[model samples]
Target chain A: MDEKVLLTGNIAAAEGALYAGCRHYFGYPITPQSDVVEYFSAKLPQMGGEFVQSESECTSINMLYGAAACGIRAMTSTSSPGFSLMQEGISHIAAAELPCVIMHVQRGGPGSGSTQTAQMDYNQVVKGGGHGEYRLIVLAPDSVQEIFDFVQLGFYLAEKYRNPALVLTDAIIGQMKEDVELRTIDFGPTPEDRSWALKIHRSPKGKSANVHSAVGIVGIYNEWLARTNEKYENIKRDEVRFQSMFMEDAELAIVAYGSSGRAAKGACKLAREEGLKVGVLRPITLWPFPQPQIEELASRVKKILVVEDNLGQMVEDVRGAVEGRAEVHFMGVFSRHMPDCNGMIFPDTILEEVKKLL
Target chain B: MSGEDERKLICDTPDCINNTLLPTCPGCLHGVVARCVCEAIDDLGIQENAIGVVGVGCHAMTAGAVEVDTISTAHGRAPGVATGIKRAYYGEAIVFTFQGDGDLGAIGLGDVLNAVNRGEKLTTIFFNNAGYGNTGGQMGPTTIEGQVTTTSPYGRDPAQSGFPLHMAEMMASLRGCAYSARVGINNLKNYAGARKAVKAAFQKQMDNIGYGFVEFLCTCPPGWKKKPDEAFHWMEKAMMEEYQLGEFKNVDEIT
Candidate 1:
């Protein structure tokens, strides 16, 4: 039986991880996402799971690395600054091919920008914040229910690919409460033969299982690099997820994600009532971006308005996807409902931008 | 004795040591500490159930030589990683961290202190060669006052660079540490003490007492600009004065 409960995005994320068999949680408390650590700390021990309030975000990510190396599902949640601190560990985890989930409850940034909501981490997360040639499976959720669902999906995809997955959210969605139906989501069987993961028992090959990031041997390193690149390509091909609405007979498509997507969706509904052919294309997977759908939409529509809570980050991807097939416009953080620090994108403001573009 | 028996006695390598890997530097004591660790695992008869979290440095290569299942963590993160491993196993596995002076005393100080403060049942083997051995002999947190290295051209000015850290003593002061000791393997007597310290540290973890730490004042001949025998003499004569041997903290219970 499934149970429905009103949950904030943070609580929903925690529940989703638990339901996904993530028995180890290592994280440090940070604003807008502390609820996740709090919930895990209170719930994990009772369930015979492990919860570690790590000393820092750096430590937290390394702990996640350790647990993941042990072939167990582990996760950590942090905000912008803390996420920045985790980049080194994330890079190592990726190189080591350890599967883990990281949730970034983004806020304004550049440097301690604001504790309020913003999508400023678009380039940082989607474009690869850490060094080296690597990509994270980025999931952007617009609502509390989606937050819960995406977190579970994140873990599944991480384990399936032996790579790290990121659930990209924001302060508004993280702090807001909504009715969430909690249920186990099965993404089919992951690789059962985890011979690569560290086990206490000696390997049958008469050698210890060593999990490491650096491959010094040139031949082995080349093989590893080839395999990792192929895995990324496979993920991109198989896991491009997005939600399209009212695009069947539309001329203008509003491309957005996360809370911005939520606002743009409301704007699309309002635009339809006013006899406008506006539609919404909300990307769920930011890295495996829905470029094919966007390209298809561009062929039909004359104009595409990309709305975001930052300075036109995702617009670059949209423009690239459209490839001059349509005129792409952007509504950024400056076009919010208010001019104050707590300003957010609202349906009315987005609709106004849509009307001007049309 | 029979020829086969003599050969067996002469080449008695621990089952936990991977014999294929090339040896460490000429006078580096990482090999000594690695043998001591493997010997401890063998003594406890937990070779199959032991896991190691190795931090980055020259000491990281030692993980390749030690045949236990190991995870090579980011520099200075072995404590955090070991904590995760120990917690995931719920003390069913014997988890330990192999780290260097720079890895532990500098970059990973907070992680080690926090792990010990949490009373996580894990063992830590810290090899302090007084400088960053892997990165070409740069000055490290444990580099002694007035010591000269590549980074410390003239000397380690206490005003410019802080005095050497007493990591084992500092760790012992923590309320969560069950056992903390500093030892060396420059001589036969000290080698025995080092083995005993390593075993005691692991025993504390096995008994679920709390965190166990053993710091080894190791020799880094190339990094210290000395020959193998000279490095051993320097460690015994100079390093020993600052980093005294013997256990700083040992208790049966948390209180």
Candidate 2:
């Protein structure tokens, strides 16, 4: 265990990468996420590591691709527009089933959106960032400690499954500062473990290997893509992460993650004070959407409340898991206005529903 | 075919060295710059450790051309990507960029400038071949005054478009920059000079000196709507006006 330090989410993530022995970081200076680049740019060389402020998100991802191909742990971070620029490379990484980490402190949408926070890119993250059939091992970290935890987890799972991992947080969580507990954890990719990665260029016993991401002259490209998708499916099976509170004996559950999950926790506390049976499913890993957990909870719970900063992204997943088994509701505040986590919708506005249930 | 996708090749240029030696036809000057940079890196014995960041435009066409680890970036972003490579993988080996006028001068200009200003220990080979070769000979920031391309059908005018950008002169203004010189490939006289300047740039980095940039005033015949021989003459008559040949900055001079 190391001494605890007050750190920003960006610095916390950088520390986690450093702790995990990730020596390579490729990124461009995009707002909100710049701290991640700034921290490592100075610190990495001191530790004999690699820190690159790439020219664009596109180049950043490609650089990570190069490093990951060498079987080394590499990472990059960006916001909305920059992240979108990364979509193409993200898809390639997912398709190649390479091990790497990317952080997206999300901002508002479309083109050149404000360099501020927004959950508008929710659909982009969980639904497959670039193209083809794939999903990043997405983690929405709310606190500085969780940023550390999730970055560690992101690296662990990425190498564990030989896939890309994304730490998806909003500007609120990224820019905000808090105490980050510096606790060491099992966060390394063992050599025996990552046999599938191309670090050693283990081209199948010298069969004159042609390692390429190109779609084959034949249709192997699609099949190759399908292989990565299949890995995502398998990873989802083993990698689903979420925390369920009071769902076992409750009538309603809040499905949320990251900053939105923080607000949902407050809402749950108030709902409990009002004597309403409310629980929450806060996802630690997003791609493996904890579908089975939500499905199991829905079997007993009467309703599901999805709280998110976006309009209706994660709620759809909650509803899909419920499949009308439970009444699914939503709590959304655009990425602009922070969720009224101060119990804005509990015991007072939704008191009638809680009272009726109680 | 001088496009972003390695759509064209430049390997046929005289005395051009092909590192990949794969089967493809490249633009004549493409192989020249590639060989120059690779030789500089090899002369410093960084072949195994050096990483090349390629930008969009024709230079990006060389994505997988070299055997070394490479990162292909968006247009004009080679310098920034190179910055990332050297910063993260410091002391592993040399880090350099191969970029065209469009990528370096126009789109990725900020990255190139700040990378030099920050004086990051990376080498940049800015290919200042005036016209944007791939996109139907479009006007690039480095396109000379009165030069005609797809965008400027009636030839370039001072009022309609500002003066062509001078990357070497501009980058020379930064104190962080260790070395910068404008060189060329189409001519025998400047080609040797270009090779020397390129080697110096990489040597500056290998010696842990700061940032180094080499801008080559090369030729693009197909893009310039001229015969291949005429392209070299055009390189001589047009590009050398404002972008004079000389060392823009040398950190060693401070001593």
Residue-wise C-alpha lDDT for candidate 2, range A175-293, written one tens digit per residue: 78898778768855444643333222222223211223444421387677667767777887877777777676677777878877776777677888867778878988778788888
Note the DockQ of each predicted structure: 0.69, 0.12
Candidate 2 displacement at residue A74 in angstroms: 4.8
lDDT of 2 by residue, B1-255 (tens): 667987667544322123455322334377667767755655555555656677677666553455455555545655654554454444455777888888888877776777776677888888778878867689999887888889998888879898888888888788777888988675678777887898888877877777888987777788887887787777777777757887777776322
What's the lDDT of the predicted structure labeled candidate 1?
0.89
Where does model 1 exceed 4 Å of error?
A203-205, A216-219, B1-11
* Local distance difference test values of all predictions, in order: 0.89, 0.72
Say which candidate scores most in lDDT: 1
Q: Pick out the ten consecutive residues of candidate 2 chain A with the lowest summed lDDT.
A: A201-210
Docking class of 2: incorrect
Which pairs of residues have clashing backbones in candidate 1?
none
For each model, chain A TM-score? 0.97, 0.88
lDDT of 1 by residue, A148-191 (tens): 99999998899899999999999999999999999999889888
Model 2 alpha-carbon drift over 4 Å, by segment: A1-14, A23-99, A103-121, A128-134, A142-145, A170-181, A187-224, A263-276, A296-299, A334-358, B1-27, B63-65, B241-243, B253-255
Residue A21 displacement (Å), model 1:
1.6
Native contacts, share recovered per candidate: 0.74, 0.10
